[model samples]
Target: MDKKTIATALAMIPILGVNAGADSIETVSNPAPIQRASVKKTVTADVLNVRSGPGTTYSSIGKLYMGNVVEVISESGGWAKINYSGKTGYVSTDYLKSNESSSGGETSKPSGNQKSIQQVTSSILRVRSGAGITYSKVDTLHKGDNVTVESTENGWAKISYSGKSGYVSAVYLKFVEYVDEDSSGGSESSVIRGATVQRSSKSYSLDEMVEVQYIKAQNGGNLISRNNARTGEEVFTTYIIRNAEPRAYGKPTKDELRYYLDPANFEGYSSGLMQFVRLDRYTNTITADSLNKYFASKGTDCVFNGKGQAFIDAAKKYNIDVLYFVSHAMWETGNGKSALAKGQVVTSVDGVTLDKPVTVYNFFGIGAVDGNALEAGKLTAYKNGWTTIEKGIDGAAKWISDGYIHNSKYNQNTVYAMRWNYEYSWHQYATDVNWANGIATMMSSLMEKYGTGEGLLIDIPDYK
Candidate 1:
């Protein structure tokens, strides 16, 4: 309270104060903050609506885009006051991004948001009693079984099933909220609906069993199945059929190979999947209730293991291939190149950058990354650069839903990233099976290496 002391306190206010979303308090006036400077939280949402007052019912001001930075001015139980666009507003802290825009710049935290979700990841999935690892079996849920979602408990989705609340492991359900890519090109594509994909019995080669997938434009890519031709049963309320694989007549020169290898350069490497990951891992803008949707059985799942089992469980709930998801994670964290990755420095294949050369994570090439944590290093305008792998997955999901990756798919020659990159590996990569072939090939390879390859999961090739 002395004049000098008052002046010192005033100086500290600018750094200490913040405008955070709902469910959170921005400043700690009595105890003071560990560090000063209000952190600018973001709307991890692709389209976060800015509201007046402190609730969603408040009049809408404007919409916040993904990574829209805001000043955290104040906080409440689970809310934070922040500047959305040019206006001051409150948002739910449940969705408020906890990780600083900078990785390694500060210690991070998270929460539990499970048990309140009911998804159909795999058809004929089983539901259990209570949300426990040792819970008893309740019944089986076929693909497209829409059960009521409940609160997150013990890492399982507590769904209200058949007049009773039962627990369903997130692994069995893939939330149908899909990211709609703008595949404008008159290219071939297929949409698989079930949790598992089945190849017809007769066919053995890559293109044989693809009959399950419906090929759209004869651009590129093809399907493979066990049988040559068989029943057209619907998996998850959809049908998958095969088509001709695009032919990669000419080989790309060494120069073309080098271009796609670079994250900033390769069309898909940078914009396609990377964009989607950014959206998927993004935080903020969703209701606190929605936050529980991301949590697992226990707090330990989140606070440890690189956000491991919890993240795995969450992805399973969404029915995304962890390998594909993790690849993007390694891309962002630099495969440990980032200090965030335990001081492991991921390098380029040519020993240059982390994203390029080879994007690898986990035992079977998994995970994604943003860039670098906070100030470690950054990808120029990209936030969450040098950050954790999950953030990359968040970004990719967002990008895919935003139609960022599919923008260039309209024309035959337009280059695509992950959706239909003929450069990677696939038959008819350019001709008959353009986009469809590339995605199907990946799925085909996955089955060859991992599972039995029977189910509706691989039905929808990422192309068409």
Candidate 2:
């Protein structure tokens, strides 16, 4: 039950060493015909120099650090010509190692079919002048922004922004295809091509959502105890409901809270959009093979394995989203490793003595509160006669459908609704601010592994 604090920090931008201007750098005269396919080379030296020409006689224009990957244009006489920050420069071939073999004689061009569209995944992505962090930043891109990727070298993606060519870390970019807005089937503005918004009576801006859901709830004399007194940077305490350990909680910084609360951050990626997906929608795409494959991918080796048919049947019987049901169960049970997931023998429940020591299973952590999660969960399972894995799955699905998905009071049929509960904010499923986001992420991950976007419906909240 120990309270944990989490902090967010910004990265320090490195200062580039630029002694000479681009105009002063000597260009390769009558350069040999470009040969070999487009190849990436990693810098082997701690600090390699980019010279105006091929030899030591050339002036040093810039410096490249170890692990920096550069696109090699051509190589001759132990010197390699490279594309340095949109300009041509030469570096010692000895200090550069080719990432792949160069066998093809065709020359590589930044134009034509090499181009692809990519969406930014990071909250704030820096566009550097070169392919490495040491290079000067040319621009900044936010989450959900789209950029045309000309090429990818090492771990950097080459993009053209603001009439200039720049490089962004490939790790922050995701390949995305454009979807026509008209095809979205809604009037609400679609944040991403595949996601559509839905108008609601109650809506809150990103800042307002964070304030009401996290800041106000935590600071407004709530009963939950904190590890430390509230500070300017640290604003909220969130319980960790997904873990098997007891009393796991976290105090997230302001920036962390805003990142999770921002709908734009999640809407940009297909998986992130799961928060707003209606969990009651029925689909035939989900199958036992797919569910079992998802479990296999997570390396889950418990009773939940081979029970995919039970989950599918429960979802069909209760009109629940099978993917969401599986994801929720996996999250609650720590991928089916928790004691409740494994089942526990009980002789008594809620002060009611039982006739015998009956074993019960709680797959979705129903009735598992913060303090007494195990006992409460077991009692609910025992009462429902969830002595078998199939029973646990079916019973938990019914509980979720009746209590949250189809509940008249809250009407929380989606992850976002389950967490925020705009109709009844106090009736949310969990105290953890990240509870909905975590489940949505898991759902997204499972979909990416085995599901497709065909017939996918996204519901974005239209904030006032």
lDDT of each: 0.36, 0.66
lDDT, candidate 1, 216-321, per-residue tens:
2222233223233333111100002212243223333334333332323322221122211211211122222322332222133322234444334434444344
Candidate 1 lDDT score relative to the true structure: 0.36
- Clash tally, candidates in order: 144, 0
Model 2 misses residue 245 by how many Å?
A: 8.3
Model 1 residue 137 CA deviation (Å) reads 20
lDDT of 2 by residue, 41-122 (tens): 7667766888999888899987775545688888876798887766678999999875553576343322223455555655
The TM-score, computed over Cα atoms with residue i paired to residue i, of candidate 1 is: 0.23
lDDT of model 1, residue 188 = 19
